[model samples]
Target: MLLKVALLFAMLIQIGAAIIAVSLIRRTRFNGSWILISGGFVLMAIRRLFDFSTLFGNAPVFQKEEVNSWLGIFISILIFVGLIYIREIFNLRDRIDELRKENESAVLSAVIQAEEKARQKFARDLHDGLGPVLSSIKMGLSAIDLQSLDQQNKLIVQRSTSATDQAIVSLKEISNQLSPHLLQNFGLTTAIESFEDQLLGNSDIRFQFEATIGGDRFSYQVEITLYRIVSELINNSLKHGRPTLIQLSLSQQTDMLCLTYNENGQGFEPDQLSEHQGMGLENIRSRVKSMKGIFQLESAPGKGIHVTIQVPAK
Candidate 1:
């Protein structure tokens, strides 16, 4: 009788475990391992039930054992209570993992913000401090009367004035590249288009920018991170990939903002890239993670490179 009770209790526990595992399948994202565990529990319960049914060898003893029947009922109730605790344990674990990711993202976001602040300060100082000083030097040169000077002095003054002008333009360009004023005043699309214009004027690379979201604005973090990512991608392509053509597209899908970039370049295997070759891609991945976004890269030797990123618009 005690043996029969033990078998019945084991069957009850197995069935309870099977139910719990099956219920957690969705919570575990239907993981294959969890599915197999659930199946194992179900098979064990079935096997135990078969053994318990045949324990009496058709003597009809199972129904006659009233004390064993009462014990099975008590065990079933205990297993039911235990399943609830098991589920709560899984929930607590998931919550802790979520909190950990949130903490990491928060730290990364803080670091990026601080870096951007530094860039802005430096750009502002260059524009406000050095910009005017260079302009004053150019103006003083412009005020010189070249007519009264000899031919040699006139030529020297002309060269000096031209060099000063070039220096002023180069300084402004540097300041703009460090911290884009258009990105601060205009939206992301406008800023990207402005960058594209500069590239088109300076390089042989054919660049394209398309935006389905028009001029809609996102959070500052999203805008700046995306802008930096685009810049880095282009720089990588020019310096290594040697791409003649680059295309970028931006769109809003549901609650997410999607970005797609491609370059017709000499691509290399992403998995086999050296540390220096992979660093840019890794930086892009980290930036996406900081925004809690998804980043995907596809590249192969001679196949060109493609990248996709999606982040929450909110």
Candidate 2:
């Protein structure tokens, strides 16, 4: 009977040691629950050793067999409870990560929608405020040309007319930049081609464009967001990169649409910039997130920059 008790105690000690070792290894990184689990296993091991030693060594122990059995059962319950808690901790961590991703996506969508609304408002204001004012100035100048005005007054009118024309042209450019009319009339491809042509005519930098868009038509919001993102990237390259060559490409495969750009210019570390800090970069990310898309940037000092965006066609 004593030998059987010793063997059973040895088995329990081995199981307890294994549990303690696992818990200690898991707690090496300072996890509190693992430490607690290890403590529970240690207590069970000590209780089993005492019970076996008293049975084998002819010691007159105070505790009865029933009391020792109850104690063992209690420690076993504690170990089982600790394991359940550890499982719950892991599950909670996974849920927190998922929630964080969802929250980020929500915030990005809100920002992009807000920016689009602001752009539309600015376009409307320019049309309503400056467009009519310039038109009136032109009419006034034409009326003066038909009147018997002095030479000096005629020159003043001519100068005023020239100034008004210049103002009108500036306003038109601003309106177009805010929201292109070609995007509404033609399509994303035509609007992009027009942008490329305009950039080539205005800048010394070489511009290259390649597109293989196969979609029938995209929503206005999608087209505007994409156009704004591309335009911002071009502007950034011009102002900061000072690249001699710029390449823009677009394509679609299955349900995924892709836009990529590369510039041979001085580039900076992308990791150092905050997502919501740079206006251009922020807008690009916002637009991508709004479309439930992925945005990636590859850049290093003096190496150049490459941006790739992919979105599902809906």
Candidate 3:
């Protein structure tokens, strides 16, 4: 009966240790607690085994018997406390993670909504300010050209025409940046391709883009969020990384959408930098968090940087 009780106690301690180990794996913050709990349980199990062996063997001497009994009680109490504390720590970690996720979702919703409002304001400004001004200039120039004029007046008309043309170009650029017409008319893939072509023509950096979209449609907010995020990433690469070659890949794997970018540039340690140090990276992180996505960065000194993001397909 004593042997069976000892074996049962040993099994319970082992079970507690197993549970603590699994919790440690899931909650990264409880590593030290797990180690202490696991060690204590192991010691208790060993002590119980020793106690069982002694009981089944030649009787222990008085001195050894008294020492064993005291040590066994001490170890058992330590093991029980350690297991309970570890469990409490695990619960705390889980709660923290849950709260963090909720906070991120709230922040993301605010950011995207704010961006949408800004875009609308910009579009309105272009239509109201630049659009009408350019139209008036074009009409006024046509009126001037129609009148009989000397060579000098013709040159003035030509200059006015050139200025109006430049203003039109500027307005077009502003409009495109505020809200890409292709994005509203067609879809994200086409808009991205158009932007890529324009970027490649203007910059010397070589960029490769691939899209393996699962479906033909996405929410307007999602499209805009992804567009801004990608734009920010590319801008960061250009400004900091100075990479000659950059690759961007987008695809859907099952129910998750993935975006990955790799650049051949000098990379810095992410842990070493403060959150506010890189506005571009911070923006990317915020955008990813808003979308309830997973963001990861891999980089080392003298090595290039790789950023991978995954979000659930909604």
Q: TM-score: which candidate is best?
A: 2
Ordered by TM-score, highest first, the candidates read: 2, 1, 3
Q: Which model scores highest in lDDT?
A: 1
Compared with the true structure, what per-residue lDDT tens digits does model 3 show for residues 1-314? Answer: 97678676776776676566656654766566566656556665565656666666776578567867776777677667777877898899999999998887988779778977788789878978889989998888977743588888898898888999888888887788788878878877888778778766687888888898834767787777788778888777777777888899889888787889999888888778665548788888888888888999998766879999987767
Clash totals in order: 0, 0, 0
The predictions' CA RMSDs to the true structure, in order, are 7.8, 6.5, 9.4
TM-scores for candidates 1 onward, in order: 0.74, 0.75, 0.67
Model 2 C-alpha lDDT per residue in residues 45-154, reported as the tens digit of each score:
66666666665576545565665777678777767877887999989999999898778877876777787778878998999987998999898887875368888888
Q: Considering summed lDDT, which 10 consecutive residues are worst modelled in model 2?
A: 58-67
Instruction: Point out the higher-scoring one by lDDT: 1 or 2.
Output: 1
State the lDDT of candidate 1 residue by residue for 1-314, as single tens digits.
99999999998998898789789999988765566556656665665676688776675665546545654565555456556656777898999999999999888888888998998899999989998998998899899999999999999999999998899889988888889888878989999899888866688888888899887988888889999999889888987898888999999999999999999999999889999988999888888888899999999998789999998887
The Cα error of candidate 2 at residue 186, in Å, is: 2.4
Q: List candidate 1 stretches off by more than 4 Å.
A: 1-83, 150-155
RMSD of 2: 6.5
Task: List candidate 3 stretches off by more than 4 Å.
Answer: 1-93, 271-277
